[model samples]
Target: MPLAVYILGLGIFTQGTSEFMLSGLLPNIAHDLGVSIPDAGLLISAFAIGMVFGAPLLAVATLSWPRRTALVTLQAVFIAAHVAGALAPGYGLLFATRVISALAYAGFWGVAVATAVALVPANAKGKAVAIVASGLTLATIVGVPAGTVLSQFAGWRAAFWAVAALTLLSLICSVLAISAGHGATEEPRTIRAELRAMARPQLWLSYALTAFTFGAVIVTFSYMASLLTDVTNLSEGWVPGLLALFGVGGLLGMSIGGKAAETYPIRTLVLGTGVLVAASVLLAVLAENTAVTIVLVFVLGFAGYITNPILQARVFGIAPGAPTLVGATNTSAFNVGNTLAPALGGIAISAGFGYASIAWVGAALGTVALFGALWAGHLQYRTLRTSSVVAKGTAQEEDRATTHA
Candidate 1:
């Protein structure tokens, strides 16, 4: 809601664009680098690996640094990494730089949650965080497709250069928007404390929900090019358009998700995940019709994304003290899902299942996630209700003591 959030959103947008642009340009990169498409795809895998390792590590490592400095410094590193990638002479060098750039990726995500919590009031907290995180959805729609297009015209290297410039701009925004006192206090979450939070049943359940919900989506979506050409009969040129369409739905879903957070939390997750599962099934079955396929893809993107903010907010509420750790872990959790989905989806396809079968896998995952949300809702209700009663009892005792005196 604040100006600062918009600035933070810009950083997220740039990060999302820079991170995913390669998916659209995979074929081009393979050709240019004189490697196989699978080898070129390693750049994406390397980044995910970085996040899995980097997200929580950055959360823990930046415990002492001020939040503002940490964010600025991370963006700076991101800029450098992009530039390095843009100028990289070989695939090995570029892949290594991608890993190095990912160091800041986790740090930014870790700090971004902490920053949002500090920026907003208790009720608007979810929405605030959503605003920052929604940048990912936008990248799906605008940034990635735009980057992909830039790749088509200029070259894959040029896309990285564009991302480098975007990161540079994000650096300026981070420097200007965040308050000086933002990161003044050290993070209080000790490793043990963070582990204790993780040990909670609700926490692991949330992670499970995150992994499968996203994994099913990614596995199918990763091979989306095949689906469009094989099933929908789209030209290679149209893949970017379809991706852009999905991105649009994702962005709209996030904006609406922020609003939805105010009235209901867990209920929103139920609705969003349900839509995603149903839509995935429909898309898989009816993809033969081009117009229907387009609509289904849009809805799939919208429904799948709306749950993202809700889940992150759920994690933060579950572990209020360890925002950085929980937040970073969830980010990694989604990527873990992303990493697993492709291989799993490929196996299903290799086993003679059609593209639509991936949707069944996704549907099963969503069903499991729905149950997870129900469980989380129960934990959340009990925890809050118990705390409320204790506070009321404490207040009554204090009142009686003061009156007697």
Candidate 2:
């Protein structure tokens, strides 16, 4: 809503591109360095792993700092990592740099979400967070594709250099923006307290939903290039473009999800997730036709992204005490899905399953996730119903006693 948010979105865009650009550059990187493609692929995994670990860890560690300071510091770390990645001599150094960058990316987003929420009024918190998260999807539409092309045309090193420049700019904005009042201190939360908050069944279920959805998407997305070339009979040149198409859908879905979250989150999750399931089915069925595949892939991206904000907001509702921890852990859940999905997806493909089979697998996973979301809605309803009944009974008992007196 604010211009500051647009600046904040820049940081997110930079991080998102830094995180995913490698998918497009893997071949160039491996060939230049004389490494295997699968080995180079691990760099992407490393960044994700950093996000998974860095999210919760930094969220806890930075509890004492001003939100702005935390974000700036992490962005600095990301910038330094990118510089290192650009200058990295061998695969080992590059992989290590990704881990370092991940720490920053994870920490930056963790603080970014908290800062975004605090900046807004109570009524607008849902919308504010969605807008911030949308930066990640927006990166797909622009950042990653641009970086991919830059990596090829200018060399992979140039791509990292570009991301570094963006991160440095984010650091500048992080310093200039953010009001003192908004940066007011937060209550410290220890790991034990964080764990206690997560012990709630509803809280865990939300995380489970995050994990499942991420897994479903990542499994298909990791090998989406292969699918494009092998199943759809497209050129390697189309990989980044198709990926960007998915991001376009994600951007649209997230925008729609933000509005939907405002009116009725529960219904949104159930129905939005159902869309993802159906789109996955369409993608699987249409993978054979180039024209049809192009349309289905974008639809899948749109459907999958629309569900992100709802799942995120649900976690906050269930575990309000550890807000940062909850959000960070949910971020972790997304990466966990990323990690498991590709490995499993690859296994499915290797076992003689067609490339399209991965989409079917994702579709099946989406079906399960859709049902899980519905179950979460039911659980939420029952909890509220019980609380209302208890409150009403207490009021009646007090009324009767007052009359007797």
Candidate 3:
């Protein structure tokens, strides 16, 4: 709603472009870097690895820093990493840059969500965070496909350079939009408090929900180019357009998700996970038809992301005592899924399951997440009913005491 929230989204857009651009550029990167396509996909996992480990560590490391300063500094590091990526001389160098860039990107995500939440009222946090997440959706819509086209024409290195420039601009926006005193928490939390918050079982359930939901999506998406070309028989030129279509669906999903997360968080997860499972199954069965494949890809994207805001908000809800750390840990859970999905997809591909098998992998993961979501919903309902009973009992006792007095 605020200008600052949109600016935070801008920062995520730049970082997200770098994160997902590789999906479209995998073949180009593989050829240029003299590695196998599967190996190039490893770059995606590498970036996720950096995010998985870097988020909480960086959140703790910057606990005392001004939030705005930390946000800008992370973007600066992101810009430098992209610059290095643009100039990388070999696969090793490029891979190193991917990890480094991801570390900064992960740190940015931790601080950015915390900042966005901090800037808003309790009722508005889901929307604020969703606004920030819209950047990633927008990246998929514009940035990723654009980067894919640039990589196709000018080479993958050029795409890296473009990302660097965008991030620089995002950094400037962050500096201008975020208020001067916006970074530090109103009541600074202790390290022990943050740690204890992480130990909650409900928080871990949220983590599992995050991991499985994202893993289901990534497994199918990581090898989408191969599915498009080798299976659907599409031309190289069509890849970016189809990817952009997927992004459009993601944008639609996110807009709906933000509002739904605030009003009906559990139902949102249930509906989203159900859609993902069904879509993945349809994609697997209908991969042979080009028209069907295209439609299902859009459905998959929409369903895959419909729970994004809810999952993020759910983690924060369960761990209110450690909002920043919980948010960062949730980011880690996302990347954990990102890291695992590609690896699993690669294994399926290596085993000669063909590109279509990726959809099955997604379906399986989505099913697991669906069960988790149902379990979580059950826990919430039980907790609410229990609390209601206790409150009613207390009220009756208070009334009796007042009458006697």
Candidate 4:
């Protein structure tokens, strides 16, 4: 793998920290902004909405731009958005900044995945993506917890300021590290061609898998702090450490998934989603047991992230026509899940089901994803079989013509 790939990861780390840190800071943000906790949680949904709308559009808009240039430009915008967020006067401005920052974040994610794939060997695409995605996991590990601590002491705004500074460092790293033409297309793709590529059913299935699998994770994770403090009887200080544990599990899961996906992409998806469903159900059942809850958090994180490399690689593998656009839409799909999961979780909380019910939501989504993965695999097999039959018929016709001649 190239140094450039890890640099993309560093960019993801900075951006991802901003993404997940909100989960931990929701209480502070809600109190300070005079909004209810659910309203603060809506900030997460707002960010997801931006990504859903921004990713594919941005990818198409920047279709002709060099990958490295797009990445650095997006990171710079993200940094600026965070600066605004840190200085935001009230909830409304801060909410607006979240959406703006997410647009840049989504654009960066799409380009970074494309660039990371372009930088590596054909056989190593999964590993390359995992390496880049590790930045997000590491953000969970280092950035989120650190932000939570900062938010705990100084203020939530302090965490945003730190994120802005770290993002600036990432932007500088990207400018210096990524080669000018690292992932540029020789000929720019037209809008029609990109749209045509996105019309494939198999590609859509991959998107569904991304949505459900990731949504399952967010359903529980979006309100994990409340669960820990309210149900598990853990002090607020323990949330960051436990969140770090989840990150550690994610790191391990991605490593395993990345390696396994090289030869067993569909199988990896099946296994990961299966584990997610089971873990989520079990977490729901045992939500009150502090020790079991802690263990399940790690399990849930591992299962949630393990499918990432596989699904991402699957999208690129299946959509050879417009790799960048497909990757962007895939990012959108994940955010769609992100957006819906939290909103649904909030509904569950408001409906008197309590925080533990979020795990059941996760379980349901993961089950849907598992079926989606199985269907995708079936479709892939049928496509391969049809191609083989057509090839054989073509060969026979050629032979008959040669004999006649």
Candidate 5:
């Protein structure tokens, strides 16, 4: 892929690190700000809500801007927000900063995905997306752990400061790397045109599939620490290592799925979602077996992430005329799942289903996603068959006209 693609990935890495590192630092933040842990956890929901709204809104607002300019501007905003977060003296200020940072991050993500797809051939779109998304996987592997370690040694504020510094670097690199004219769409689309594209039923289906598939994984993952400690009876210290293992599985899944999606998008989705459902079921059934639970966690990551590129690529395919908006909406769809899964998992726990119940929730979501994928495949087949019939009739008409001539 283009160097700009990798640079965008690097940018994503910084933002993703900031987004996820809060999970590890919540306890420290709660204590420092004189809040309850649950209150501090709301910071995560604040970010997710920001992402859900910010993506589509910013995509339209910046629809006419140059890709590089938009990306750099968003990164600058992100850096400033992180700095504010690092320096904030109270919980309210920190929460506001998190919302602002997430807005910037979400906008950056939408633009980056569109830019990455614009930089590649149609056949290579999945791989390009995978390359960009690899940054998030890498963030889970390297950045989140580093932030946790930094928070442990230097305080939580230090982690925010580090993220701000890294974002500044990414902003500078983006300025130098992305060409001024390399916007995702050749011509800027009007908001009206993008809105019209959303009329397609298939596009909506794609978004639903994206949400369910991702939600399935996140339901279990959101409560993984509790499951490990309470159900599997592991030490809290093992949490980071296990999370890293999941990240490793995610990276591998992305690599495999990216290559396969270009040729077999439906099959890739089906297999990935199917495996995810199976893994969740297995995890739920075997939670008490420490080794089995550990192995299933890796499988969960792998199965969950393998469908990501396909989910991303299919939206672009379905809505070729509205790349930016489609990208933004897809980003929103992801956060929708991120936002909902935790609530559902919490409800299940509150209902006395326990930590393992989250896995059952995941399995249920994955099964829905799996059926959605199969339905999409059927629709694709019908569309192709109709197109083929039309083409054949046109060819026959042309042949008859030629004979008359």
Candidate 6:
């Protein structure tokens, strides 16, 4: 992989930490801003909403810009937003800053993914994506926890300041490392051309698969703490450690899937989603058994993440002509899942289905994703067969004309 790819990953690490660290700091934020915990939690939703809208829009707006320029500009915006957030005296301002930060983060992610794949060979695209995505998994293991600890010792504002400083470093590294001409589109694509590429059915299928696959795990993961405490009978202290364990599993999954997805995209998706469905079912059935639940949690993380690189890489394959827009829409699709699954899980809990039901919800989503993968494979097969037939017909016609000559 290119050095620029790793540098982009570093940028993603800082932004991802900011994205998730708010969860740990919500209580502190709520108390400081004189708001309810639920209200503070809306900050997270605000970020998601920003990501959902910002990615596609910013991607198109910057479609013709140099990749390095777009990335650096977005990082600068992100750093400024975080600084504003850290200094904001009231909740409304902080919320506005979160939205701004997320918009920057989402735009950065779309451009970064496009740039990473552009820097690598077609065969290595999945691995490149995995390398970039590893930053987020690492953030789950290291950054979020460290931010929580910092918030505990100093204050929540300190965490925001730290993220801003780190992001500033990333922005500097990005400026120094990435080449100006690398990953610039050979020809600037019109917005109409990009939108035209998105009209493919296979591309939409890929988007749906991406959503369901990620949503399957998030549905359970969003409420993992409650399940671990109220159902598994573990103390709160164990939650962080177990969450770290899940992150470890995700990292491992990324490593394995990255190497396999370029060669076996459909197979990787099938196997990964299948395991995810099984793990969700097992977690639901055996939630009362602490050991079983713990084991399945790791399995759930591993299974869910193993398909991530494939999902990211496959869209580029399906819509090679419109990588920027495809990348942005894929990012939006991911947030769609992120936003919906938890809400659905909350409804289930409100309906008295219990926390375990979220696992069942995950299982259902995974099943849909699993079937979608198979369907995608079928579509690829048919397309290949049709192309083969057309090629053979053209060869026969050429042979006939040569014989007559």
Number of clashing pairs, model 1? Answer: 3
Q: How many clashes in each structure?
A: 3, 0, 1, 0, 0, 0
Kindly list the per-residue Cα lDDT of model 3 for residues 118-182, writing each as its tens digit.
Answer: 88888888888888988998998898878977987998889999999999999888888887655
Residue-by-residue lDDT tens digits, candidate 1, 185-235? 554547677767666777778888888777756666787778899888889
- Candidate 5's C-alpha runs over 4 A off are 184-186
The models' CA-based lDDT, in order, is: 0.80, 0.82, 0.88, 0.88, 0.92, 0.92
What are the clashing pairs of model 2?
A: none
In candidate 2, position 208 carries an lDDT of 83
Q: Which stretches of candidate 3 lie over 4 Å from their true place?
A: 26-39, 181-185
Compared with the true structure, what per-residue lDDT tens digits does model 5 show for residues 158-179? Answer: 9999999998999888888886
After superposition, the stretches of candidate 6 with alpha carbons farther than 4 Å from their true spots are: 184-186, 403-405
TM-score of each candidate structure, all chains considered together: 0.91, 0.95, 0.95, 0.93, 0.98, 0.97
lDDT by residue for model 4 (1-405), tens: 788888889999999999988977999999998999979988987887899999998898888888877887888889888999988889999999999999999988988898888778889999999998899899989988889889989999999999999988988888788865665444566768877877888888888889999999978887888999988889988887888888899999999989987898888899899999999998888989999999999998899999889888888887767868888999999889988887788888899998899999999999999999899889889989999999999999999999999
Q: Order candidates by TM-score, high to low.
A: 5, 6, 3, 2, 4, 1
Q: What is the lDDT of residue 172 in candidate 3?
A: 88
lDDT string, candidate 6, 68-90, tens digits: 88999999999999999999999
Ten residues in a row with the worst lDDT in model 6? 180-189
lDDT of 4: 0.88
| Superposition error at 57 for model 4 (Å) | 1.8
Report residue 273 deviation for candidate 3 (angstroms): 0.4
